[model samples]
Target chain A: MVFKGAEMVIESLRKEKVDTIFAYPGGAVIPIFDVLFDADDINVVLTRHEQAAVHAADAYARTTGKTGVCIVTSGPGATNTVTGLATANFDSVPLVCISGQVPRNMIGNDAFQEADTVGITRPVTKHNYIVTKRENLGKTLREAFHIASTGRPGPVVVDIPKDILYQPLEETYPEDVNLQGYTSPGKGHAGQLKRAVTAVNDAKKPLFFAGGGINVGDSSKIFRNIIEKTGIPVVTSLMGIGALETKNPLNLGMIGMHGTYAANLAVSECDLLFGIGVRFDDRVTMNLEKFAPLAKIIHLDIDPSAIARNVPVEIPIVGDAKIVLEELYPLLDKKDRPAWHKTIKEWKDEAICINAYEGFNAKEDDSSYLMPYQVISTVNRTFPDAIVTTEVGQNQMWTALFWNFKEPRTLITSGGLGTMGYGFPAAIGAAIACKDRRVVAIAGDGSFQMNLQELATAVKCRLPIVIVILNNGYLGMVRQWQQMFNGGRYSSTHLNDRIKADKEDKVSPDGSPDFVKLADAYGAEGCRVRSKSELEDALKKAAALTDVPIIIDCLIEPEANVWPMVSPGAGLDEMVFCIEKEEE
Target chain B: MNHVISLLVENNAGVLARISGLLSGRGYNVESFSSGPTLDPDITRITLVCRGDDTIIDQIKKQLNRLIEVIKVSDLTNKHTIDRQFALLKLLVQPGNRGEIIQLAEVFAAKVMDVGSDTMILELTGSEKKIEDLVQLLDGNIVEIARSGLVSIERGRKHAAVSQK
Candidate 1:
């Protein structure tokens, strides 16, 4: 039977078992949307902007372990997704973004909404295709999905011209893809694995350094088992959060610039660093020369290039993390490093004191301001099992540090790109992917406004996402950096309308838009929280709402900074602790 | 260090862009590049000459291998291989200098393809060093030069075939 290119797209998606697509429509994609209008099997989520659509799809892929899908029209619609694609590429999220293009004849003619979609997206995408013929639509789509979801998964784009979608075609979805050049490592080399086991056995202090690849490779459970069998302490990169339960005593918090003092010290002092599914990004390996200086690093990852890229490795095993861990588990011998544990315990205690936040005690101190830590902790407490997403900057750091993520895929954030305004839309995606799980997006005042338009999407879908805006009236992280390095020249970090207001004014007229009112305008519930008690009450109220999104604008400390920060280019051990350090 | 890399890639639209874009985007220096279809119509072979340290070259090869279009990546820098380049030179053939340029071209086995009233276009296919010598021998008389970058292959039965591994 002959079918139109649009039908082939839907059929291809159906064969892939894709149930939802986060998308935005425009001039170039009217025919596809026309077909989607009556399509009941596929749920089309119409986000306000193209960027949000891709971000939502990326988060959806993260939460469900499925290849997320999104469709955007040509030109600006396609370009807007660059940040989202780069975000997914860096974190290795599997996504298929379909972009509508001008007609084949008009593609390079500078016609209306014409774009070099494939060229623009080549670097950010794992691979991309421009379908000039209707006959190749189904096969190209199958290839897109296959490429996106396999072997260190990443985003891929398929650009179909507008005329191609209207033409008739004989369609057949290929059952299997055969890309000779694209092969993923499945098993570790026996020789290298043996050497790694030997290193693990010989070390007095061994550390497990985990990254997002563990989650993307679906090896977290095996990873935790490896840690359990070896009795080794672990520290994670930001994207590696939730790979090991925060409840695990041996699981040191995130290890990076804003990593826990204990985690950073452990990376610095370990005799052997066994990294699984991690590339050792510069953020994690600050001052690479001094990073893990004493460690004989053993690295295992699915991507061959990731090894020895940043830090040198004594043993490099290139393979899928799950398969590698399963093989290594039998070779491992349990160790009892009493002396190393004692040292780590002292560091953990020091970290706890440095990270201590005055949660729910501001009333006793006669302070009316809400702290960022307090707001994050309260939300974490209120929804203990909720899926948490965070916008970049201080909000992200606080959530990464304070949220007790006990399961994999529970904390979703733009770890690699650090894209601002990613959380709310990502929370929307997470909510849609897992309807039973409560989702919360912790955003900053500056970051929240970046994609606040997605509130309409959340409301339309009736997603029970609680967006907690820690409104600090300034670009908190940048302001903190300016305060530290730029001689207190706040510059353009201030977001408040009243520029002359004292920087200390906790409740002074906050910038425009009034978040609560903005939520109301979008038909979502909204409230303001000032003190610790108000935040708790507002969170409780938000938790009860199951059919609509709720915006909680928690007025946090204006000058609050994420502490224990390692200055850029400094060693991980050179952390700038908070003022509350225990009397030297 | 300078290295020559041979790659077998799927003959597809935008394959070249994906490769060159990745190299340039990563700040790897591409000194020279040439690509053409192999014996198989569906496959194209690209040879690129790049300059980098050992670590940088290692990463460049891995990154190239990561591209879906690339079928095989073979670094011929230290391998026993045969390398050749093709060039078309337009030389200024003034009445007096024509014989001197012709003598230099003949020594390099260059073919005198076309001779106009005042210029000579010579076609040469040989090793890069041979081409360099011919250009050096007639440095001032040459008006234009278009040289194909290096194309290299393993010397013996060892081939960058897809099924070899």
Candidate 2:
């Protein structure tokens, strides 16, 4: 049987067991979709924009632990996917995006919808291919999947010209392609791993610093077990949340830029800082030179490039996280760490928020305002099992700082790329991937506007995603930065730029466009709330809805900020909490 | 100190960009770079020179090895190796001094590859010192010169080439 190039795409998708695909059909890709239109084995979701498709696929891959697939046409369709591709690339999410190109002959002629997909996406993708001939389609597509789902999985693009889709073909898909130079070390160097394990056993104040790799490597169970046996305190990078249960005795919350007070302090004072599957990004190591100064470091990462790229480590073990942890577990002589826990608990006591302490209210002074922290903590407690996604800025930092993420892959945020329009579409994708559980997206007004158009797609599919928008009327994170560093001149950060008609000196307190109206316009349920009492009732109502998507826009204090931030150039230990309450 | 890090990598498109990008991204200065295919057409042997202390060099090597297409990387900076550079010089040859130029080229074992009415082009291959001396001898008369960066092989069987065989 001769298969056309389009058939080969479906063949590869089937081979990889990709049941769900996020795609946008265009003129150049009609042929590929035509074949899929009648297929019963695949379920393809049509997103409003190519970018949303990619983000949806990204979240799907992250939550399901599968290689997510997306398809788009040439030119704008392919270009639009850049941000989503970048997000997947930075987080090491396995994704394969198939983009249709103009015919092979018309590629360089500036033909309609033509794009240099491979050239444009090179640096952002793990690997990419331009399929020039009909015969090369099968092998190229197969290799694209292999390369994407391999070690340190990442996004891969396969740009196939239109002419290649239809051909009279005799087939020969290779038994196996020879990818000679590609090999990831499965087992770490025995000597290096042994020395690392020895360091952990010898140190009294050992700290296990886990990162997103725990999820990527499928090693969270082993990591939790080992940490329990070892009695070492644990601190996580933002991406490393859910590496182990946050409630674990050993687990200290996330550490880094907006990390909890105890976590950063523990890292500063620990004797042995064992980092697993994490690149020491700036957010994680606030000031590299002063980070973990007292700790003798042992870094275990599958990506050798990440091992010592930032701060130097004494022992470097390059191997799969699961395999390395399995090997290292046997060598450790588990010991209790009482002194370390006592030190960490003292710091935790200082980190707790008095305002978010169950019943505290911001309504005492200003009856019109609600605190952002209260909304997030309320959502966390109401739907304790929900997978939370947050857009960039205050909403993301607030969720990272306050929410309790107990399991790996439960909290999906754009940690590395910090993409603004990510949370809602990603939440929809997560809902699709894990249909039994609830997926809630906590976003700021500024971020929600960037991808609010995706609300139409969510309602069309009845995704049942609950979106909670903290309508602070400003880009809260940037405004906080401007307030603290720029002499309190709130420049372009405020969302409410409209001047009031009656009051000459006052800016309009009304938040623009009314999020409830925007939600209603998109054909989904919308609720707007102001006082603290109304916040819980709205969230509960939104959470109870099962048939359609729900958007709960909470009117929050414009001056609300993510506290305990490590100023850009400062050390993690140098966090200046915004604790001196400003008079209302 | 300058370190020469050798890498055997897949001849995949974008592999070179990734390796070079990694160095530049990490703020490591690349002093010299030379790359070409090994005996196996599928693999290319890459040699890059970076200047740094021991800590930085170690990071550079580890970074290079982290690239998915990079098969192996080693620091050849301190290893005993045979190294050479190739250079081609085009010089203006006055009628009165043409013989002197030919004699100088002969002494250095440089081949005269082309001769125009007013100029002669000489191709020379040797250690950097020899090329430097030849250029010095042909000073003022030389119009333009192109030099290949340094390439090296370990003195014996300690390099990647012999081990691959």
Candidate 3:
């Protein structure tokens, strides 16, 4: 049957089993939107901004382990998805973003709403295509999904011109299109896996340094099983939070700057650091020279380049983490490393805050203020089974630290890109992807404001996402950095109008909008709390609401810093647990 | 050290831009890059000469391989290979030095493509060292030169694009 290009797009989506898409409309996409209007099979979420649409899709993909889809119009609408695309790209989230372009003939003519979507998104996407021919639409769209959701998955852009959608063509979708160059390696080289297994067996103090790939590759079960079988302790990157249950004795919390004391110390002291599906990022490896200096590294990753790109490895096994781990598991010789476990436990005990410790309240001259950690911990306690999303900076770090993520894909955050304004919209996505589970977003005052407009979308969808805003009244993470390193010069990092007004000694605090009122304006429930009791009460109330989203604004201490910081250039071993007060 | 990487890629639009962009975007230093349609119209062979240490070169190769368009990336640096660069030189042909320039070009096996009243354009294809030596010999008399970077091939039957075949 002859099909309009727009109809073919929908046909491809159905073939891919896509039931929903987050999109924002504009002049270039009117035809596609018109087709979508009657496309009852697909649930279309209209986000206020294009960026939120992509972020929502990204989180949806992360939680559901499916290729998330988003469609936006040309020019500014397409450009707005850049940040979200980069976020997904960095995190290796599978996403197919269909951007409407100007007419094929006017693509380069600077026509109205014209932008080089393919050119602009080239470096940030896994692969991109500009569908010029009507017949190529089916193949291109299907190939876009294939390229996006396969090996080392990432965002792919398919920029289809407006005029192409109007053309009719016979619908013939290829079940699969094989590209000559691309091959997603499944099983690792047997020899390398044997060597890796040998290294693990031989080492006295071996530690599994898992990254987001464990979750992304769906290898968490195998990873945990290997850990269980071998009795080896594990440390995770921020993205690797849920790969192993944080409560497991072998699972030392996150490792790196701001990592649990045990996890960092164990990494520093371990003999074998088996990095599975992880790129040893600079943040994770504070001082590369000193990072795991004593460890013999065995790096296993799906991406061949990732193996030896960051740190030298003794055995580099290139394959999917799940397949490689499965192959290696049979070769592993179980061992009970009591001495290593003893050492790790001792290190864990040495940490200032024990595992599962609630956040400490801020103390200043007998006045107590709510801490960011307390708010996050309170949410963690209230919604123990909820899928938690976090904004960047102190809030993200705090959540990563305190939240007990027992399973993979439970804690969704922009770990790689560290994009602010990510959590609330991501929560909206998580709520949609898993309708049975509650979704909570822990964000900072500044980050919540960045995309608070998404509240309207959440309210409209009747998504019961409890947003816990740690209202510290400042850009807390940057402020912490400025305070520690910039001689207490709190500059542009301050987000509170009251503080800024005091500093300027002129402007009124009236400019700072009340978040509760803002939430009310968006047709969602809103409440503010200052004390611990009030915070719990608000959380309980918000959790009870089945269809309405509620914003809980907790007035946290402005000066709370994420402690145990491995100061930028310092070694992970040289973690400063707490800063000594300087003479004023 | 400098490395010569031979790549066979799908002859698709934006493949070249993707390769060059990967280099510039990742801060890898590309000394020279040249590409053209290969024997198969659907394939393109790109010769890239880049400067990097072993780690950087390894990363450059792996990154290039990571691109979907790139079918094969063979580092011809350590291999026994035939490497040549083509250059077109426009040299000033003053009466006093015209014979000397022609003689130098002859020694280098360069072809005289055109001769103006005061200038001559010579087309030369040789190893980088040979071209450099000739340029040095004809130093001041040369007005301008355009050089195609280095294109290399393996010495024997082992083919880089064998996988495609």
Q: Best DockQ goes to which candidate? A: 1
Ranking by DockQ: 1, 3, 2
Every model's DockQ, to 2 decimals? 0.90, 0.49, 0.85
Candidate 1 ranges with C-alpha deviation above 4 Å = A357-366, A497-510, A579-584
Q: Which runs in model 3 stand beyond 4 Å of their true positions?
A: A352-367, A497-511, B162-165
- The true-versus-predicted C-alpha distance at residue B28 of model 2, in Å, is 5.0
> What are the per-candidate TM-scores when only chain A is compared?
0.96, 0.95, 0.96
The sequence of per-residue lDDT tens digits that candidate 2 reaches over residues A400-453 is 877888889998999999999999889978998999999989998899988888
Error of 3 at A302 (Å): 0.3
How would the candidate models be sorted by TM-score, starting from the highest? 3, 1, 2
lDDT for model 2 comes to 0.84
By summed lDDT, the worst window of 10 consecutive residues in model 1 chain A runs over: A498-507
Instruction: Assess the local accuracy of residue A133 in candidate 2 as a C-alpha lDDT between 0 and 100.
Output: 74
| Candidate 2 wrong stretches, greater than 4 Å | A172-177, A353-368, A497-511, A579-584, B11-28, B31-37, B50-60, B158-165
Encode model 1's per-residue lDDT on A217-290: one tens digit a residue. Answer: 88998988988888999999998888999879998889888899899999999999988878798888888988
Compose the digit string of candidate 3's lDDT tens values, residues A474-494: 888999889888988999887
TM-score for chain B considered on its own, for each of the candidates:
0.95, 0.91, 0.96
* TM values, all candidates: 0.97, 0.93, 0.97
User: Where does candidate 3 chain A have its weakest 10-residue lDDT segment?
Assistant: A358-367
